[model samples]
Target chain A: MRNRLKELRAERGWSQQDLAERLEVSRQSVNAIETGKYDPSLPLAFRIAEVFAMRIEEIFLKG
Target chain B: MAAYNLAFRRYIRRFVPLTIAYGASVALATAVIPDGAPASPGIIAIAVLPGLAVVGWLWAMARLLVELDDEYLRMLEVRKFLVATGTTLALTSIWGILELFTPAMPKLPVFFVFPLWCLGLAVGAVFNRLRFGAARCA
Candidate 1:
């Protein structure tokens, strides 16, 4: 999966730490997901979307 | 800051007591039984009590992992445990095969598996640090 997590986080002036705090995960997790080294589970994906007030499809796309 | 949850704290607390008890039981069994002699069924049962504690520790570890809400820490833990499992299985199987052909090799009991697995986890923690920058886990 590919995601616009970094771009979205940047647009919101949120550092990876800021996003991670909101997601209740470590900054490394945000980094992993952003760099495409890790893919969030469905529940986590939903949480991410909720944090950004966007749809999951807007943030993540299937390759 | 890297932090552990209440469940993790409880897990560690539970581990300490169980480990002390396990050590005591193993020590008592070894001291009371004769060396190189087969023990009675009752004595064997007493000696294996520490083995049950080892299984309990694994269960606690699993429960701690499940209770964690942090994704990255959880990922690190899952990777570490998988690496540990692979290392233990590989080393033990190799040793078992070698013992069959090499008369000089010492025999390994099945009870030693958990200790080997624990050693593997230590090795896996080092691997995690190299791969992920830090070995943070609950």
Candidate 2:
């Protein structure tokens, strides 16, 4: 899956660590998800959506 | 992140003592039980200590898996364990076949399997780093 996590984070002036803190995950996980090396689980995706105040589809896109 | 850190610290606490116990048990067992010694209950009990220590190490690892909260990190750890298991099994099978076919092949001790699995874990960590871009999550 592809995602706009990096772009969204950039827009919000949030670092990976900041996003990870909000999501209750490690910075490495945030980096991995942003780089498309890993796809977050449904619950984690939901958390990411909540963090950005956006829908999951808006943050994550089909590849 | 706090959960992961706590779990990791717990793992270290368990691992350090278990390592010392493993070494002490091995040394004590070897010193007490000489080669060609008769099988006695005392000797058997002494010999079992090392195996028990190994079991403790395994238990520590399992506990770490259970306690870790980050799903991605946990998944990476599980993948590493699977890779280690696969490597250990494949190598042992190949060695067993070689021993069966080749009379010159040296017998591989069963105790070495644990160490072999450890080496496999290192290989798996490297594989994870290369493939997943992160090996040590903690």
Candidate 3:
């Protein structure tokens, strides 16, 4: 579950903490997603896409 | 959606330390009590009550932890509680059975049981949290 979360976050000058707040998750969760150590649930993935105004496929790459 | 939700951060900050504190207090109490001592109903009550309080605290904390909007987080917490309950029951049953078979295996003082129980609960929480949070570094 690779994602463009980091890239998008960086573009907005948002730290993982910033992204996690928006997603209503712990910062660690955000870090986990960025590092691919955790795969976000579908709704969370959708939320991320929604935040970035992109399609889910554009943010997440299935392995 | 926007980026760190205050509620989630507050949840973690509040509960993680509570779990750790409960565990440390229980462990300390367990270690302080002598294993061989006279047992009585009163002593057992003393040993069990504080541990029971810690459980209550953990339960209360769990409620707060799940107050956020993440269903996944809520699910993980519920699973942790279930695991803790099952493990505690199994451990207690085994200890009781063991006592019936051999009374000489360093009979833990009745007064110490509460602290030990609390300690067990605390340790259980720590393990659950670690398992859940470990991937954060990955």
DockQ of candidate 2 compared with the true complex: 0.76
Scored on chain A only, each candidate's TM-score is 0.97, 0.97, 0.94
By TM-score, the best candidate is 2
Task: Compose the digit string of candidate 1's lDDT tens values, residues B23-54.
Answer: 88889888887877677897888878897888
Candidate 3: the clashing residue pairs are: A20-B4, A21-B3, A21-B4, A21-B5, A22-B3, B47-B114
List model 3 lDDT by residue over A1-63, tens digit each. Answer: 788888999999999888887877777678778888678888988888888999999999988
Higher-DockQ candidate among 1 and 3?
Answer: 1
Give the alpha-carbon lDDT of every model: 0.84, 0.89, 0.66
Candidate 3: tens digits of C-alpha lDDT, residues B8-121: 456567656666766665666577556775576655655665566567666655655555455445555555555556666677677777877987755655654544544555
Q: Which docking band does candidate 1 fall into?
A: acceptable
Which candidate has the top score in lDDT?
2
lDDT of 3 at A24: 74
- Docking quality tier of candidate 2? medium
Please give the distance, in angstroms, between residue B64's alpha carbon in candidate 1 and its true position after superposition.
1.3
TM-score of chain B of each: 0.86, 0.93, 0.50
Question: What ranking of all candidate models by DockQ puts the best one first?
Answer: 2, 1, 3
The model with the greater lDDT, 2 or 3, is: 2
